[model samples]
Target: MSIQSFKFSLQTLRKEGGISQLSYGIRVFIALCGAMALSWGINQIDMVIPLFLGIIASALAETEDGWQGRVRALLITLVLFIITAFGVRLLMPYPWVFGISIALVAFCLSMCGALGRRYGVMAQATLILAVYTMIGLNQATHEMPIWYEPVLLSFGALWYGILSVIWAALFAHVTLRQALTSLYIEIGLYLKLKSKFFPLPTRGAVDSLRLDLAQQHGQVVVALNRVREILVSRIDSNPTNPRLGRYIRFYFIAQGIHERASSSHYNYSDLAETFFHSDILFRLQRQLSEAGTSCRKIGEAIHGGHAIDLRDSEETVAGVLRSIDYLEREAEPTQWRLFRSLRQLTDNVIALQQELDKARQLEDISLSDASQQIPQPRVTFRSILSQIADQLTPKSQVFRHAVRMSLALSCGYAIIQNMNLSVGYWVMLTTLFVCLPTFGSTRKRLYERIAGTVIGLVAAWALITLFPVEVIQLVIAVTAGVVFFLSRNNRYVLATAAITLMVVCCFNQVSDGYDVIWPRLIDTLIGSIISWLAVFFILPDWSHRQLPMTFAEGLRRSADYLRELMRFYQEDNVSEQVYRHSRRRAYNADALLTSTLVSMQQEPGHFRRDTELWQRLVIRSHTLFNYIAAFSAHRGTLIEQPSNQLLADAGNYIVESLQEVAQCLEQKQLVTDSSAEFERLRNTLEDCPSDDDERHYFVQSQLQSLLGQLEEIRRLTLELQVQVHGEHIKDVK
Candidate 1:
């Protein structure tokens, strides 16, 4: 490639997270090379294995944080490494003492996850380092002092930590930029998925599409959370930086766009049935799809550090406006209710376009809003201890997982001692990597571990036979290490294969690599079986057990969101922070329920017998959330009209019904039906006069839609309750 083109390609890749992955790989390569060079220079080549293992552990412990945070994390990691390593050394002679000590250490470390993601990762890495220390002890010679391996391992971790901090300092904004880029891309995909509803597909297709949209929404929420963390870190570290302020404004813009895009004005099926013959639905679909494309283009610009040109987006908005004008002029008065919804959808699109335009010229924006400050959690020692203490129960998933991991590791160690395998630590290592909090994840990892090991062993044999030179093998090992880091999150099988190949190559440096292959495979199988058994039998966190609480949470958040919207309508001045906070919590809760259902699907069939009912509940709950979003989208001052009282009554009824349903689900009691009350509200809504006020009319339509959605939701919740608790509910006025 030409130099200019190559540079452009690199910039694009960086924006799309490719270069970020490459940067991670490079860091690992650099750390490994430094350790190899230093060990060979000092003629202490025996130390390279421990150093390499420490480097890997440190890398695993790393989280996305600013330089300051990284420094803090690094200190904690180093301290934990020292304690774990030396503790292993002191207890190594007594097998029983060592096994019980490691089990206790495992539970304590696993419980550290209650502190936060950062501590959880560090704890996991520390546990793995303990296992590595065991492996190193097996290879120790009498000439090596007891403190030798622990000190060198700590230094190896320090070496990688230094590199990470330097990288964070130099590229402070890179992670944030990547995160924002991903957020916009996910939002764009969500909009496109929403566009599919306009085609008026079959019921099955629509339900499937709704599920897909929910999954995509989850991704958007995850991206937003990541961006929130990075922005919070950077802003806290340097509050006065203009660049960070601009990024904060960009984040708020993305939030606005997501809220508008996620809003549903009316039922898609009903809209399609009413306007199937009209080109207006098609026009709206085209506009939404184009808006999605614009979002993606804007994301690309952000990634590439290029100025955005939104002339195309402007044209798309104009086309949508023209279509709306045409529809308004030609539609019959009988379809005016649905027509109003169409107009609202068009307005939402225009607003989304405006947000995109703001993002385009974000350089000129200033942070004027007081609510732009992202809240940071206070991390006092007492608070940390409190968080950990809260998780110290059998009901806590983290607690259960900790107990399971401790027992599994102890069992694996016993197997290792009894069998006297050459590299029994590999079995423990496999258990660590394979065991997760959920049955589905653990099962999936078990299969991938076995398959990847077989592939890696076969590939390693072929490579060693073809290229027997030690230097070539070393180069291959480094490359494999880089690949392993690059693909670890998205492609577990490939990562497993890459790491397996690297292990073989590393072992070949000091011994016959072929001898390690069979033992590696055998240890993996043994470990996989142990992890599988542990997760299945020991406090298995089945998703079915949590679905009721999850469903209730979703319902309660939806009601809270509606309550906020009602307050916004009733009060003169509501805080944007409060409204946005409620909206985000509602969306997050909906996303969580959807994800939980997905996890349940991956579990055994008997555990998910109510899957269909749960699916319907999710659809109705999200639909209710969408109706509230629509009301939020069109929030405006309504002059004191007769309809205002009706609106208030209808809104109060919907919120109460939602809360009641949530209460019933949580308590596993029968849901009380309010269909008669709902019908009376619907009749009152239909009888209310519009008084030429479009805003009032819009509010009435949204309330009407919400009432219907709540009725369906209540019915589904009742059916689900019956399925879950075998209770029959009766209608109550």
Candidate 2:
């Protein structure tokens, strides 16, 4: 192959493997420099080895994302560490004295995870590394004392942490850019699909939320309000920065799409009327053209007085082109059904664009006030559990996905480990392979493992030839830097490869780095195969099924927690306490929702449960939670009792229906129809005569609305089961 062809093929291979191999050469150069500095710094007689605490510091201080920030990351990391650590630790027994000491350390960490948030996650990971790494490294015949190991490990961790902070702050732009691009792509996809029918076997009849039929329009106002906030700030950022512009425009389009789609979800056959016609399509085209042009002009304005030349921002240009493409596609004779919805979407986009301008000005004026507006608190325990239920990022389900490949990962890992070929890469590759949120995780794990291994070999060959083995110190420094970069992403594959490359290089350097490349490359291939087998066979992640169960659990738990909270509120002289279990409940609830959203993309089958009836329920639950929180916040000035019978009735209905839903799910009899008497009561309950006359005297004034709500929900429960499960409801006679 030509040198240019070889290089091009190698680059493509690395990217396909998700290895970021192109970054290796640069890293090696930096490492060589760092080695020179570090060697000199250490060579000075009696000099104290500099503690590289940057990684630790960065991990600690990172993320302005609130609560779920460091804490969640830390928890997952710790869990991963324990799994690995325990696997090896069982090979030998520690002295009782050391065991006791470790137990104390473990206890302290268990308490920290309970504290929750960024701290919990970060601390758990650190402590796990601290504990397990200490044990693992000690297997060396000339082991350092436990105390010394912790100290040294801390220094190492700290150094890496600093690198992480620097990497995340500076180069995290790459990931952010990709995310922005994805947002746009997702938007375009949503529009295209929504333009068509829902693809149900029965096409003419639509299957949407019964509740949606009641309040679809109610949603547009709320969604537009939220979308406007992110939309304006994003579009108003520096447009000259391509990375920033890409992200901002992506955000604008996604928010606009969401607002547009939500209007459809809420309104009846709004899709048929808005999308299935031609005049509306033309109208939509005119509106979007105006809006897109205005947006392009505004973007130019942000590009520092650069006249609106139209070619500066690729992202802006691309967004405009996409808008045009969508419009053109709509103008086609075939997409008439989309015409109606497209026009409504056009109107929302226009309105939201105006709102964006207003929000931008208001944002500046409200900056200080906004800062004080109680940034979202740490995700409660309930939210966290909820996330688990929702299978937000079912990293664990990497097993049980695809059979052919899962067998491959298991067989691969077992064989490579038996062969003793530095199976660390295999372990890591397996981790990555199982993370396909939307794709088949099992297949991805095997595919990525092979791809990464091949890329690593090629990258190593190139980088090793460029830097001599004597530059060992440089290799370490550069590897450290790359590791810093890796921590910026959740996947951490690229950084892991960087660290792996250095270790492999370390083994090579010790052998005078004079070895031919063929043997090492072949070994890497073997290890890669092992990784594929481990993920595909032993621990294949069945991502699709996990999301549904996880989400359902979170919803059930959230409802249970709310019921408990209400019970607590009703008792007089009782202290309003957020108990530990209740806190767990809350954290799980939020976590589940976040996970639900995350996993929805990864596993389609599982996610379908959420998109259907559950969406209506979850969203309504969110409203209930918000209202409850608001009520609790101002408990002192609250009404002596809820005077609104309808409101109280709605609340009761929600509580009861949710309780039944939970039981139905738990019993695995989710399709069971509502009992005949309850069905009659539900019908009677819906028609609240005189908005009060309130057989109302029969209900608790504070809970009358809740009761009414429960009845309506009971009716909905039956309808949804029929809709979602295709279970026939027996005659209510």
Choose the strongest candidate by TM-score.
1
Q: How many steric clashes between backbone atoms does each model show? A: 0, 97
Model 1, 1-733: lDDT tens per residue? 1223423543454433732676688789999889888877898767777888889999999878888988988999999999999999889889999998979999999999888677899999999999998888876545568899899889999999999999989987777777777777777778888777776789998888888878788878877877887776666676556777777887888888888888888677778887777777777777677777777777767777898777776887898888779778888766666887778778888998888888877763343342255666777989988999999999898999999999999999999999999989999999999999999899998999899889988988989889998768877877788778887776778889988998888777777889999999999999999999999899988998888888899888998899889876777888877877888898889888888888899998888778888887787777778778887877866788756877888888888888888887766678876788888888999898877777787788888888888889888877776765663543333
The alpha-carbon deviation from the true structure for residue 715 of candidate 1, after best TM-score superposition, in angstroms, is 1.0
Q: RMSD to the native, candidate 1?
A: 3.7
lDDT per residue for candidate 2 within 176-271, as digits (tens), equals 333333333223222333333322114223323323221322232222323333333333222244434333443444344333332321122443
What's each prediction's TM-score? Answer: 0.94, 0.49
- Native-to-model Cα distance after best TM-score fit, residue 45 in candidate 1, in Å: 2.0
Worst 10 residues of 1 by lDDT: 1-10
